[model samples]
Target: MRRTVARRLAAVLATTAVVAAGVAMSITNASAATGGVTGYATQNGGTTGGAGGATVRATTGTQINQALCNRASDSTPIIIQVEGTINHGNTTDVSGSSCDVGSTLIDLKGVSNVTIVGVGAGATFDQIGIHIRESSNIILQNLTVKNVKKSGSPLSNGGDAIGMESGVRNVWADHLTLEASGGEAEGYDGLFDMKNDTKYVTLSYSIMRNSERGGLVGSSETDLTNSFITYHHNLYQNLNSRVPLLRGGTAHVYNNHYVGIVESGINSRAGAKAKVDNNYFEDSKDVLGTFYTDERGTWQTSGNILDNVTWSAQGSENYPAGPSMPSTTTVSIPYSYALDNASCVPSIVAKTAGANKGNQVSDGSCNAQSPSQSPSNPTTSPTTGPTDPGTSPTNPPGGTNLSLGAGADGSSKADGTSYGNVIDGNMSTYWSPSGTTGTVSVKWSSAKTIDTVNIREASGTAGNIDNWQLVNHATGAVLASGTGAGVISFTAVSTTKVSFVITSASGTPRVAEFEVYA
Candidate 1:
């Protein structure tokens, strides 16, 4: 039986029930009209059963904390809905009169499956957005958290927009916008912090502007995929930090577009293995800026850097702190075509591996080098002719292109010939009167690019075709020969020869068509 592959899809559910509960609870616990401070709380009704159950309604950070400390472990998820804005006058913005740093907006501990969405449009002047500790399965999606002071006072660590302590897991943070417009010394540190054993987390499709340190910091095993992370995309005029710091775990970083402003695109460390593929990095001063080595003293390694276009790395520097091990510090730019910059060159300098094995720069130019040839064997001609007149013409026709047709066994062909003369069965053999001692002419009309054509002994298994040859049709030279089917490719040129010959075969050889393209 023939084989084929299939595709997979993911699912998304509506938030109607969760939103309805929030609306009903908002009416009963409405705050006072004086615009001072109030308290409200609700829980997510999801059946997945984690810590995503709270909605709080404390205007002041102090009031929000008091409400959270009073909730039972299994009561329900708390939704902290701030009724009105509370402007504390303290500059530290933690626990005083200041709107910036009196108390944290919401502090979550030992919670799971909890989400904190915006209640209304004008929710503003909050303290730190959400502080999470030892939480799992929590989602903080669709909230506009801004004007957060990084540091409360002169001798403290700046408040992060969303801080995840040592034990967070399986967290999904999406569609969040954090604005830290405070001074450089007093601004927030990072938008999202995943440090100390935070595993199986995803930070996707969020925007951050003007953070003092960076955008995101993942210390341990984490997966950061499908995120639009760019300094230029953020509304801030000046970007002063790195995009993401992948410290541990095998991070899969793909499909992200990065434009650096002040630092490199990614700052990986401690022998992290990052699969960075299909990403567009444009005009970045640094790309893959710095990294640490593994326990074996091997520098930070990348899994595969496939199909990434780097516009410029003008101010970028390779790792090793000053390049003591020149071989270890050198970067591999695989499948990258670098233009301008004479020093930068394509990873695959030539068409084959032998041409690029040990050659170096000469006169600032690397010319075409010869590739190795395959082992030679006796060449033979096909012992068979076309099964029908349309495919094999006995008499000479003036410039009429001969085309193969569908075999009698229901195998479709471009030429549409309908006959059973062509052999189409396992262990089947057929021979034509048309034979050449030195060469064989096989013709077919195909719009697709023909790569490697295989001649298989039809009786063998799919992977065990007994007689095969790989011919470069453009150069008209036999490239390689093997035990299985024939493999042919178009070498920057087009051809109509869909046929091959087996000099000798352990069993009767059968022909099949295979095509490859650029």
Candidate 2:
């Protein structure tokens, strides 16, 4: 960032499990909160931000636009709770009717179930940048957004530290720490850009450094319907290229950890279709393909790990993917993700990429784990809550239920209702949805490594499942959300299916038992 000293909010460790050489790691309690909402913002109908809403406590940027102009509409569903530093004179520009905040940094226009998370002693937006337009379900947890400037003196957003354009959709930006301070002749730009038709997005465990642009999905070259995007376990350092420069559609870079990068990375051009997996590029240089122009883009690499990488020579606008990184193309991916072995991804993204560390993760057989929970900070104290998450569970904690025999389905049900009656252990046999909202799932045939879940509601229909969204349907990872539901934890993940939609319901909603654990 521009350095003015204001970055402290990471401390959590009380052991959840650890083994090392033999690999057993599963840790996740460092004041919990983040371990859900993974890649691709968990597909279209996922990204349950601002859970059930109503939970304000801003600390500037005009109380986060007066908490979205005191929401009640504009897709009501709040969750401000920021604390400390939000420059440009504490962010102004208020107006109301459920807001449309402006003045650069922290814009988020046309709101929709918001969530600007980042609590106590943390939440820096210095030099400002956030500017999502025509918004949709959004969630920007544990922030740090840095330096900014498009050409000097506090002129934000256009400088891109988190710019999403017109048709933005589901966005889940976890543990951020975006930076800038040089490039474009030191005026900064693209730290997370997405253009026109931006769709399902997910930039997990973030940490993009030193600036020089490290963002772009579709902002030109036919602006191709900004497609389904997903970049997991991030940690792009020293930047100089669009660690994200895809131009057309479809992207899913997994387990990231690129370093130094310097002139190019990701660059997929016009018809973009990247699928690079199990990443861990080091000492980068032309981190991926298509640079400059000529319009060309397509990738499908696998199990990548280019240590001390550096490959350049091939002009006419340059085109490097690596010393022998072939694959050219072959990308399908509907959903269902799990891959964490590009040689332990640089020690699990340096103890969990960005934000305050602690939200560590891996458990896909590379060890280390920790997720969900987001308030009352401090495995050392800095205050951050949300992982003891909207509360409901009494002893009904973890302890096996893995959806009992596992194998159910949903999106529509009712009549005699049956998605295997909520996984069978009968809480009076339930599962309803034919009206009043939908989605109910559970499946398994391999892949399972959960992290608490328990819906249980029957007898007089305790609360009528009003507001939910805990996904993982293979790889749409969203893990947690709130509003009536006993026990709902999050962090460890390895899925095979696990939906539980329900969006909103105050009546006519029954789900006798949907238990799950790990």
Candidate 3:
């Protein structure tokens, strides 16, 4: 007999009635407002569970669960700060025949507007997972979910490192590192799985590595209620398949890096529509489209880079040949985000994506002032930094971020800080010239009209560019000269190259951002 996923999950899962009671109470106490937040907390489930409430600290899984249980019916959002490893209190008794549900774990069933964020080095969930059932407006960030086991244990929600199901909505998981040592046969399931009508979620800057099963949405082809999920800037490394096996939902996937997909990748079936854009896939096989299952899925692909990718031959079992993915539908993204060119994705993602312990995240399209918002709540960090002249502040307007994924040439560069940092839109990271007299330049494939340039001084390297020359390589014209970290405007000039030449400095010259605009 074929073992259906529903049979494996529902057989021992939490009862619908019991979950509904908690949800009902939560809804009753919840604010009439939706998941969106105001002011400082407009990103990531919009102040989920922590808005206008006191923060609670929990050290273990039981304490975390207890804190959530205490606010089971409260509308006032609470923030549960998790510190250290949340392990222990895992039960082995299976409730039913297959899924091994009803286990004593950190179950966030029947909760709303909750934020479980890891502090310091970030929280670790060792051999245990957080189950989000019948919950809404949740944020799980900076947490390392590893070693979620299924051996001799009644794994709730099919042993997912982070499982969401049954009316779950408005969840933002950022900077999480979800990994597993083994696959399902070794008692491990998906790193992250969403099923049974779960919707309106975003997974950004997270890392899913070294696991056989990465994640899946909508358990089976027939189970099509899940929808509206956005995955951006995530790194999927060393996975076998299902970097999401999407089913029956509109998933906007962009700027993700996939490496070492052993068997297949991105099984989109049962009418699921995936918009795959601007992603980098390296050393992966069949990185997109349906696999193993005969049910057909749909995807629209654009701006993707495939390097050293091998495709599985077309057969009855394999859905589509990869390296070039096929899609059945057109998808329009409902938010604003920056897309790094395929060539630049690897470098850009390496510097910007994943958990940067003490660093803030860039807004990769989550917050907007528009009132006519889609049910799918998006998130991005607030835009700050130097604006390119003659261009919009967010981007170079009509111009490109010349430094973006652009090859950097310098007289010399500091170790770990490459010349690319000067234009990656991140001020915290800078490109320090190896010596005080060294120069850094950004060139384009073709000539670009540039009239203004902005230079951000590295925090510790201020006054390094005491005297500098902005040289136009094409014309060998010194366009302008600067002595500080600010805008340097000059006459409009078209050139294929621009260089920041430090003529004098107090210390080693460091440029955080070297932006040009037309």
Clashes of each: 47, 21, 11
| Tens-digit per-residue lDDT, 287-311, candidate 3 | 8877777777888998787866788
Q: Which candidate, 2 or 3, has the higher TM-score? A: 3
- Listed in order, each prediction's TM-score against the native is 0.41, 0.34, 0.60
* Residue 56 in candidate 1, Cα distance off native in Å: 6.0
lDDT of 1: 0.35
* Model 2 CA deviation exceeding 4 Å by range: 1-47, 51-64, 68-104, 107-128, 131-150, 163-183, 193-212, 216-229, 232-240, 245-262, 267-421, 429-510, 513-518
Task: Compute the lDDT of residue 377 as modeled in candidate 1.
Answer: 14
Question: Tens-digit lDDT track for model 1 on 1-518?
Answer: 11110100010011212221232110111111110000000011111112223445555546545544545642344545443453343222333221122243455666554444333442343454566667654555445566566556422124666777666655545345565654356645666665655554544334554544455545432433212111111121123444566554444443233322334345555444444433333333344545332321122332222222232322323352221211233222211111111111121111111111221111111232321111011123223323322222123223222223422221122222221223332224332211110112343455334443323222232332223334333333444443434333334435544333232222222333222322
Local distance difference test, candidate 2: 0.73
Candidate number with greatest TM-score: 3
Of 1 and 2, the candidate ahead on lDDT is 2
Off by over 4 Å in 3: 1-49, 89-103, 153-157, 359-518
Q: Which candidate, 1 or 3, would have the higher TM-score against the true structure?
A: 3
TM-score of 2: 0.34
Per-residue lDDT value at 356 in model 3 = 35
